[model samples]
Target: MVPERRRLLSRRWFYLLLLLPGLLFALPLAEEDLNAIRSVTDFYGQRAGKRMQAWRELIQRGKQQQWDEKRALTEVNRFFNQMKFLSDVVLWGKNDYWASPMEFIGAGGGDCEDYSIAKYFSLLELGLNDEKLRMVYVKSLTYQQFHMVVAYYPTPAAIPLILDNIDVAIKPATQRKDLVPVFSFNGSHLWLMKERGQGQLAGSSSRLTLWNDLRSRFSSEKLKRPKLNLDD
Candidate 1:
């Protein structure tokens, strides 16, 4: 995995890896997709250009500084939580859809799943082990609706920290009593959650249809109306 290679290489070599084309653009916005972002935002009159510029700065700052795991959690959770939440029907014109991180930022709004997806990918890009982060599906007792969040395990056994859009705070899973875990997943594994967010390994995350669709469309930006002002 990239994180393994990152640990083996010196800090000097790690920075060089960032330069490799398509290896990972700090943010994966292509010129044409960016143009489309502008076109849609023109009518809305929000500064899409400036918002993206701020995102670039976040990526740069995160890379230059050696951030701790908790610091990485705070930085990423706070950044994307700034975006508005909309239903899948409103944002993507579907009953249920999952957007990639770039698509979530490009459109300026998405549902809970979007917040989790963006955080999961951004954390990985920041060099966290893929195994340490899992996207969890939970039943929100407060709202009586299904919701999603990103859980960060310092070690596989550590009580995971919850990164959620609704709360927009990094708290331990034990503190999130309102959320009843149903299951969890990442790129490699799927888990069937038992009581209190603990999970039993199920299978590959490929079992998730929406997640697979999101990955397939990640490189190809699907232009939607941009409404977020990141600088705001």
Candidate 2:
């Protein structure tokens, strides 16, 4: 091979490797999930179909390819942030409602908490460790309302990266001056956060009554997954 062509091929191979995490083959989806998406289309129409199809592809591709953590964060944030923002009252006829990833996509939109919860689950499905992710509840000073966002903690004591639908740009927690974090939780524990960092443990995530109800709905209402958040 010519020197130039050899280097070009090498560079191309390197880029290809970046997209391949482990398995080159795509993951299989259950028939019931496919039926569920069709039902969503029947009720919610083509727009919902589009959202559900895209979400399905995102999970399948993320699972199929070996996406680096940064790529996982970027794609998941971008995918969910595209969802239209709707209040719980407007979307679910409630003061506060938490939707599963399927419900969030099927409805074609949701509140901040929905965005965060969806992103958190998507990453988890892609094989990201639960320890590295949190559903954070913060006060959005910009909007003067309680909000929810997903935070990626690279290390236990590391300054976490904020995955917020409101800002739509993943930045370190220190850079998000407009949000004052009140608390954070994952599938395991909950913490009351101080300004920019995690605080003392409050309790297990099961203590959040809404989250418990949401977990049950994730089974009867949507696709089954290991039982499992808020707005952004």
lDDT to native, each model? 0.74, 0.78
TM-score of each: 0.76, 0.80
TM-score computed on alpha carbons, candidate 2: 0.80
Per-residue lDDT tens digits for candidate 1, residues 144-198, read 9999999999987889999999998788998999999999999988999987655
Clashing pairs in 2: 21-66, 112-231, 112-232, 113-230, 113-231, 113-232, 148-231
lDDT score for residue 67 of model 2: 90
lDDT of 2 at 154: 91
Q: State residue 173's C-alpha deviation in candidate 1, in Å.
A: 0.6
By lDDT, the best candidate is 2
Worst 10 residues of 2 by lDDT: 223-232
Instruction: Return the TM-score for candidate 1, rounded to 2 decimals.
Output: 0.76
Residue 160 lDDT, candidate 2, scale 0-100: 96
Best candidate, TM-score = 2
